[model samples]
Target: MNIKVFIYDDNLSRRDSLKALLELSPELEFAGEAINCSAAVQDMETCFPDVVLMDINMPVVDGIEGLKTIKQNFPHIKVLMQTVFDDSDKIFECIKNGASGYILKKDPPQRILQAIQEVYEGGAVMNPSIALKVLEYFKPQEQKSPLSEREQQVLQLLAQGLSYKMVADKLFLSFHTVNSHAKRIYEKLHVSSLGEAIAYYYKNLHQ
Candidate 1:
């Protein structure tokens, strides 16, 4: 199957170059291009591409914010961050905001095509350096995630500044059961106090 893709980047030269590179693949088709996040959003509504190649440093709403909007509104569209910088902060922020891949601006055309196909197959792609950073950052998150889904829901509600009674009412469960869920959530998250739990919740709200 041919994968349709949209390109978003501020630089005209880079955007066109990337588009040219993507066209070389028989399995990939260029859907459209946008100069900024706002334009990208409009293009997405019209074209509905399977994947988006986004640049991290754009005017108005940067790639990170743009990515958040895309993931929230169009969950099926995979986003790949393409930037010149290989810094860990940008990589982590992009992944946290639901980017499916990260490729350096200098990466070969074949590599970018491969990254697109990888994400299409439900696998995340990252530069080796960025991959290492991702593994390091997510290790603690995985450790905190061993809780059941109900427990997680209860913890999320409580962390949103909701009282136990409110959470129980929202979940339609007894206060005692809600309390048990909260307790288990705290234990699994390795947090000793409600404040700590809330802190963790705020920290990992996306995951």
Candidate 2:
């Protein structure tokens, strides 16, 4: 399906350029365009676009405020932020305001289109530099795992080279119960495989 896109930029030249780029890509459809997000909810309701390309700076209602409004009114619509300034504060503010993607105005047309498609398909997108800034901003906070005692026991046993059956026997649990505990452990640790779970266990142990 062609991804429906709406643009909200005050710059006529930038809006025109984006429209021209959309015209070239068969996978994208230019649903609508607006100078600012003054009528953001009304315009979005009118177009029902799958994704919105939003400019960070606008005349009256800025993109950050616009993003918050759009998300509040239409939580399902994905909004991708665009800006010339690579300011980390604005980028983080957009993210906190529920923007699905962030891109620089200097980014190539193809990258902008890719960001649209990605957000439309339920993926978040960000420019490399913006991503780095976001990472740095969030790197200071540590995420604590919410593993239960039994789940942690299961992970520790798995890390110690014990198979699920062996762990079950040692812990006096049924095989199915042990498997369930292992699954919960993997989920709490956010690891896909036993190896990753074991690695996480050892990494935390040393930390």
- lDDT value, candidate 1, whole model: 0.86
Tens digits of per-residue lDDT for model 1, 14-83? 9888788877888899998887787556778998899999999998878988898899889999998999
Task: Please give, for residues 1-207, the per-residue lDDT of candidate 2 as tens digits.
Answer: 889999999999999999999999999999999998999989998999989999989998889989999999999999999999989889888888899999999999889988998998899999999889888988856746577777878888888899989999999999999999888887877889999988988877424
Candidate with the greatest TM-score versus the true structure: 2
User: Where does the lowest 10-residue lDDT sum fall in candidate 1?
Assistant: 138-147
Which candidate wins on lDDT?
Answer: 2
TM-score, prediction 2: 0.68
Each prediction's Cα lDDT score? 0.86, 0.90
Alpha carbon lDDT at 105, candidate 2: 95
